[model samples]
Target: MSGPHAPAQREHGPLPFALPRVTATQRRRAAALLAALEAHYPDAHCELEYRNPHELLVATILSAQATDVGVNKATPALFAAFPTPADYAASSPEQIEAYIRSIGLFRNKARAIHAAMKDIAEKFGGRVPRTMDELLTLRGVARKTANVVLGNAFGINVGFVVDTHVERLAKRFGLAPADATVAMTERWLMALFPRDRWCDVSHMLIWHGRRACKARLPACADHPVCRGFGSTCELRISARASDTDRTKSNQKPGSASRAAKRR
Candidate 1:
């Protein structure tokens, strides 16, 4: 994680364009993109299931390198066992590990969860802090996690949630450069979309990434918004090229003959 307020960067160079200098045409396209996504995913939202702020905070932390579905599978038993910040604070890291061992980075996550819960219990009076500054003080709570918790749990759209899905889709849509960092992408999105729709924009892009413009084999040929963009959709062009390359590879003399005989 970078500085609490700083955007996390990759090893690549800086973004091609400064965020503050976004053009009028780019803003119009961004608005159209958001509208299409809203029409596509009418009820797009945070897929992580949590009944309260604490649960959401923990789940977002757990979802670091894992899928939301995977986190959901573990949270029920974990949340049931330690239903409160004080309960989690009282439990040993090893005990917490037992419930969430199925998730990736369980040991470190267990430590973070235990330590964060302890902070909440002792420092925040057993409640999750509502502000970005305060939330960043919790273990494993970066801006991304802070945004997720603030936006979904508290209706505060402080910033966009730049998960892998959001990052990929943002680049695909040409909203940000391909080499842009999560923080840079978030900044571009924040500048492009309306403040009130910040949270929903993240959800909509995530939903599209999951359902249509996937990492591999994106449904670009028939995707409504993607088709509208047509040749300008870099992801669609890339997907088509990849499909062609795959077809060529599969048609190699021995491979095609063998597959035909098997069929």
Candidate 2:
């Protein structure tokens, strides 16, 4: 966290990128959270597997409301079949659905992939657009998807990614106000961190969320980051324990539900 890739230093004054509502205190707190994430999950990165920009774009589109694992499981064959944007543009959406039927919202994802690929082939000369505005013109590529592509595929960092995990962690850690919308959350995060570290910030926070600060229950009572954030998580922890106990009592030992948490 203290080398060429370190967050920009501006501790003596207001952060230049911060929005009007952001205070210097919040910026400092945000820096601590960023450090905690780095300390805990230093190798955090985009989980979606891809060999090229188009592949990443499709994988991201398929990832909507779907798990990265699920998308990864389906992508090998899909990528093999349609190796390029032109391949997808040449085929019909129905054909695309055949490869991704296992993914959630396969039909809609198929349409998005088809339309987006068509756009890339016809509009962008078979290359995924690099800028946010350009990427948004393609179907299924909203802000989150654009951030993922811009940060991971092209090594650009224009905004913070505000996915479910980022949103949950942002609120729990008080990075953004509790009532912040997705766009507002992104803005708060962008304001708090430097432009250069924005990509790293999103990856680290997402990794922390998936590994510890989960939506249903977190696994970090003793973890330093949770403690540093002034976590009020004991109530939820106790509630989960009680629910787990009830579930165990209700179900027989070694049942299928035994491994499931009280989600």
Candidate 3:
């Protein structure tokens, strides 16, 4: 789980662009990393709860720019009202909007969901399309949603799903370069990890990213892989440790002793 590349030895002693070839050893280490993460996040299933493919698709449509918890909150009633693609297609945009208005961009999402459902019911016989090409034919179904549904619901990993957390974590962990675009990042990840691990890895990384390694202030000191990558993370860990020491020194003697014992 060391850095993907090593520093180059030059006139200045070491330059940063000396990328190592992808050896079998490195691949094995990467595989170990995958295994470790899988062990830690075993229950890392899709947070968007759904009974079937259609429900998953609808939930995913509602999940854009919105938290999964919020989407889940609104989905019970929404799913009850429009239990199928045909049900959503039959309803008006106004009716859908009224239910999911708490979510961001509800008005447009209502329209997209309704339009997508109409397309699905008419063109695909009321079942969510199974292939990437077919899924893309829906109005709001981009690569992200298509990948989620295809991978989780249909056992297909046609493409990597690069969401915001994935993009941030990929850059931070040196899985991809800092400047890599989402499409490029996805390609890099797919190439690095095995295809069969894609679905589980995506969810696990996302869960880890949100819970342990946040964008603003990742708990890198507590992260097992934090030492494997990132100059920023190293500094963050050092600073966090220093801050903890300072806070401990300021605490009452008994409390400080308890904290020290806990540490």
Residue lDDT tens for model 3, 47-126: 88777888888889999999999998998899899989999899999999999999999999999999999999999999
Q: Return the clash pairs for model 2, or none.
A: none
The TM-score between candidate 3 and the true structure equals 0.79
Give the per-residue lDDT of model 2 (tens digit) for 118-161: 99999999999977789999999999998887777777777778
Q: Which is the winner by lDDT between candidate 1 and candidate 3?
A: 1
Error of 3 at 255 (Å): 37
RMSD of 3: 11.6
Q: Which portions of model 1 miss their true places by more than 4 Å? A: 1-19, 230-263
**Across residues 148-184, which tens digit of lDDT does each residue of candidate 1 receive?**
8877776776677898888887787788887888888
The residue pairs found clashing in candidate 3 are none
lDDT of 3: 0.77
Candidates in order have lDDT scores of: 0.82, 0.82, 0.77
Between prediction 2 and prediction 3, the one with superior lDDT is 2
lDDT of model 1, residue 220 = 72
My TM-score estimates for the predictions, one after another, are 0.82, 0.82, 0.79
The parts of candidate 3 lying over 4 Å away from their true place are: 1-26, 228-232, 235-263
Q: How close to the true structure is residue 165 of candidate 3, measured as C-alpha lDDT?
A: 84
